[model samples]
Target chain A: MGIAWFVVLSAFIFCIGAAGVLTRRNPLVILLCLELMLNAGNLALLSFARAYGNGDGQVFALIVMVVAACEVVIGLGLIVAMYRNKLAIDADEMSGLRG
Target chain B: MIFEQILFFVAAAGAIGGAVGVVVLRNPFFSVLALVGHLLALAVLFLLLRAEFVAAAQVVVYAGAVMVLYVFVVAYIGGIEEPIGPSAGPLRVLGPLFAGVLLVEIAIATIGSGLRAVSSTGPAVADDFGSPEAIGALLLQKFLIAFEAASFLLLIAAVAAVVLAQRRRGLEEAGGETPLQIGRRPPTGPQAEDPAAAGSGGPAGRAIDERTPTVAQGS
Candidate 1:
């Protein structure tokens, strides 16, 4: 396997994640797909880091992890707030601005 | 060498399978678990790529803390499966199609580039290249600003999560008692003070209530 293999794998995972985000109605699943996409990016970053013999990509991956955690935190909080308000859990039902 | 190859293949398979499972699983809870598997597999890949510190972080932060939050949220949300909506008709078909096209495009772009000339063995580096100490030095030296910014982002996110999940005052006024006030509180202390404050709080609370749905929809 060359660098291309890992890059291809990363792309494959990203595409899977994008499909999930597009197809899924559940916000939780959409968030999971977002994580998937981020991780795929991390994989590509690490692979390139490996190829280039540097630590910048690893550091970037660490920052990406922090951002991912923060995103999940805010997203789940929103979901909980939505649930508390007795709103419909489905994403489509919550679109109040649909003109 | 052969063992490393086998390990890479195994981790790759696990990662892909778990990603598929996350999307395919109907139960949100199951999806969360599948994501944990995916993260673990990615950690292994990270290790294989010589990102030892990053691998550890992936296991600890992404797989551990983040996934725990996901699990708790899924449980709290009652793991309700999404019913396919009317608008989902075309999207269900088009989503995978577009994603497949994207995959092909990315693959061709990356593989057909000069990156194809690069070998899998990669370049040689110091023995401590991806060790924790090395990455830590980079974090504190080269990437100190970003590291600090990340910590600040985490802090803001923590505060935002708490504020966002706070029980709305409108619901409290409507229910005549706060959710936390029922059964969990002393019978006489806060309960007696509640009605005295209700009238004074109603309009302001309703104003917040009118704003609440907009914030909720912002997600």
Candidate 2:
């Protein structure tokens, strides 16, 4: 029952996050949305782990946590430098590479 | 059924609302905050599922670290005031259309999956792997290689950031400038008041030689 409830909740959150990533122009917001989706994945994995009485899902979630850390750190470092150079964070204004 | 439906509804609302906030909010900082809220709700949901460790990981890593990095950069870039428009034609239409499709897809998939779960006859109960000890064993025993690989990836990312920063235009230019040049304190002696600095620089600029090192110190 408990795991069942969590599965539903995470799914819902995941959907919302995916939508945000699609609609928002801000790169930072898009990153946040991506994080939300990842959390949803972690949730689903955790629920399954609990339901089947296994530790693998939790371990997978830990790996995911580390990956998430790496992603954000790198992502933010790039964003910081980009913002400093260009004076803007809007994805649209970045036309140096655009055709 | 009745109680589960209610909890599900609350979770869905919180998730959807935060998601909407992430999209609709103009300020990236606010969007990040909404994302934190969304992640928190999902973490609690994970706890409800008996995956206590995953829930904690979600909070510490996603909500705590990832989000802080996001918010900090957003604040640093607060001065970025572009007209704030979509990049291309496709992006303008693409954004809303993608969001709409995702919403519809989630609804259908949720229903389909629930039906499947209800009919399945797999393990009647989940396991203790959601516990910290069980997770540790699985990570160290079965998935150690993958674990090491992820660490290697992190190292690569760190190196890449450094490389990218060094190669970037501003960084390249900044690197060429000495501490004195950066703070507008031109070189002293014969080069002290270079002709270009004397012509382009104002009184304050002319007074900066001794102050360059001090300003760098302050910075």
Candidate by candidate, in order, the iRMS in Å equals: 1.4, 3.6
Off by over 4 Å in 1: A97-99, B83-87, B167-219
Clashing pairs in 1: none
lDDT per residue as tens, model 1, A1-99: 466667778998999999999888888899999999999999999899898898999899889888988999998888888888778777667777442
Which prediction has the highest TM-score against the true structure? Answer: 1
Give all candidate RMSDs, comma-separated. 11.0, 9.6
> Model 1's lDDT to the true fold?
0.83
Off by over 4 Å in 2: A2-11, A95-99, B1-12, B79-90, B113-127, B164-219
Docking quality band of candidate 2, CAPRI definitions: acceptable
Choose the strongest candidate by DockQ. 1
Clashes of 1: 0
Worst 10 residues of 2 chain B by lDDT: B184-193
